[model samples]
Target: MGEYNMMITEFPPGYRFMPTDVELIEHYLTKKVHCQLPFSSLSPLFQHIDANEFYNISPDNLVKNMCVDGGEQYFFIHGDKYFGGERGKSRVVGNGIGYWRCLGEEISIYNSEGDVIGLRVNLKYFSESSSKNNWTMQKYRLTCEYDTSDTEIEEWILGRITKGKRNDYSNYF
Candidate 1:
């Protein structure tokens, strides 16, 4: 028998990775963080979804290396925090030059069984001049017991970045 390499090099043409909020959190994000994804034979394609250093580079640069789907790029990033100005304040800002600010309160993600499975927060990036950039991000983290506290430690988070205007999810139901 001739030697052969059995591996999935790419997804089918025109295949999209668009997953709903719940699926992003409960399936991909959770599985990636827990190392439970059965991707031994598909690690190459699966590895592209990991954006561990998402905060280390500019959004524009990050986009260049991502597989964008419908103008939305999804990746798995480690949740890191720094103490912001003022006492006991911490922020999830990224990028060395610009800063990301929370656009609104974190939204709760519920499964079909009415259980809160995860949380999603929207963020907008602002330059040094305080001008809002076209880049926007939606970060989803798995739900835990300490979700009510701001000091809770998050391990892995799933992020969706869009270059243009933010998409409204009011009709996601």
Candidate 2:
């Protein structure tokens, strides 16, 4: 059969697509990190650090409440949790600017009474990119505790869409 072509209209300048959280989780978070969205996006460091709601605590509160006293020099706080009849903190220490692997993951599911009900294995990344000042990654894995068991909830892997690929899609359309 002969080749067929299609035409696609482009949006005007200043117009953009806003992805829903579910869409972002499914497409961007699950697939890759370096994938470009329609608009200029913030760096991962800013995104992660700026999001206070995710951990149910603000940055100020984190620094005030969870900091390891004098451990702030060599380490950055990751999270603080009160669950599963246990309360603890998690952090990542400076190991130089390089790849840092996830040795393992722990998930604690708690009931309303703050008691452990379920636990399970959660997969983790073998390695991730880290700089002296920031954490950047091609791919990373996340685990979550659920009613049933721990779940491998998200993976951030990076893939590039090259100029040729863009041209191909434009021409194909």
Candidate 3:
């Protein structure tokens, strides 16, 4: 584990970084958005990538950049807003290759007090070459309570990518 509780160690044998929705919001995304996490903190589970590159690159190429052996790959990316669009209202499309389409309505993540703290938006990647949805991503964003009027700070979100249908979180550490 590293200084910010961002685990940077390679899995010893069977362990993996699989945080629950609350943990993902409170631990990782919260720190990242607040500028408390360092850019050098690299782990097999978590990698940071620019929003433009992340959305523009093909999922196959993105997998090659992953450190995990298999299953889900996590990333910290700036949540890009659509040109002249309201926040969290539009789907983010890629440049000419493929794009991410939302699965359904955003799911809310609540704290122990029953307060909504974050939201999870599920998205699937469709390639222009093939019609199949090969990649799945869960984008996690903090709610208004965490915002401080800084759009830049609020743009950070945690993205989890899976090869196919989402994996069972119980199987991870």
Highest lDDT: which candidate?
3
lDDT of 3 by residue, 118-143 (tens): 88887777776887766878888877
What are the lDDT scores of the predictions, listed in order?
A: 0.63, 0.27, 0.72
TM-score, every prediction: 0.65, 0.21, 0.76
- lDDT tens readout by residue for model 2, 1-173: 23355433555884433332233334444332223332223331123322123234322233343223221111111232211112222223233212223223434434456654333222111223421212211122223333433243222222111111111122332
In candidate 3, residue 46 scores what lDDT?
79
Candidate 2, pairs of clashing residues = 6-173, 32-157, 33-157
Give me candidate 1's TM-score against the actual structure: 0.65
Per-residue lDDT of 35-150 in model 1, one digit per residue for the tens? 66665643433334434365556677777865443377766565544212222222433544666677766788999999999888887666664465787778787766544344
Better model by lDDT: candidate 1 vs candidate 3 = 3
> Among all windows of ten consecutive residues in candidate 1, which has the lowest summed lDDT?
81-90
For model 3, name the residue pairs that clash: none
Query: What would you estimate as the lDDT of candidate 2?
Result: 0.27
